[model samples]
Target: MDKSVELLKLGSKIRELRMAKGLSQAKLGAIVFKDQQSIHKVETGEFNPTYIYLLEICEGLDITISELLDFKK
Candidate 1:
């Protein structure tokens, strides 16, 4: 797969996990030290999250980074 597609997959996985946890983008952003707009950009695949940001989001979601990448729907 292409890198951009991988980013989109990652973003979709993150959005799924966040919604499953009943979190708003703003709330998830607080955990990742970002703003809701940033989170929205990520979910829409408009931005690629930094490694640190991805780590923080996984931690905040109480999921492992590998789990976040496991886009099994």
Candidate 2:
């Protein structure tokens, strides 16, 4: 897979999880100590989040890294 495609898929997956939990970007950002714009960037694949950042996102979403990265579903 292309790197851009992978990033897009990761972004989409995060968006899906956020929506499933009924959390807005602003709200989730608050939980993760990020701004809404930052969350938007992540969800749009405009940002390449670091491992620690991903951990924070997963924590905010109440999920494990395994769950977050398990795109096989």
Candidate 3:
């Protein structure tokens, strides 16, 4: 798949997990030491997160990197 498509899928997966955990963008961002706008950009696939940011997001979501990238569902 294209890189953009991959980003979109990753964003969707993050959104799904965030929703499942009852987290708002602001809350998630706070946990990740970012802003609501950053979270928004992330979830919309408008920003390419750095590896550290991705690690922070996974940690904030209480999930592993493998879980975050698991698109089989």
Query: Best by lDDT, which number?
Result: 2
Residues 1-73, candidate 3, lDDT per residue (tens digit)? 5988888888999999999999999999999899999998888889889888999999999999999988997
lDDT of 1 by residue, 1-73 (tens): 6878887888889899999999999999998788999999898888988888889999989999889877776
lDDT of candidates 1 onward, in order? 0.89, 0.95, 0.92
Q: Which pairs of residues have clashing backbones in candidate 1?
A: none
TM-score attained by model 2: 0.96
lDDT per residue as tens, model 2, 1-44: 68788889899999999999999999999999999999999889
Cα RMSD (Å) per model?
1.3, 0.7, 0.8
Q: Rank the candidates by lDDT, best first.
A: 2, 3, 1
Q: Looking at model 3, which ten-residue stretch has the lowest summed lDDT?
A: 1-10
Ranking by TM-score: 2, 3, 1
TM-score of the candidate numbered 3? 0.95
Off by over 4 Å in 2: none
- Better model by lDDT: candidate 1 vs candidate 2: 2
Each prediction's number of clashing residue pairs: 0, 0, 0
Q: Name the candidate that leads on TM-score.
A: 2
Q: Candidate 2's error at 24, in angstroms?
A: 0.3
Candidate 3 stretches with Cα past 4 Å from truth are: none
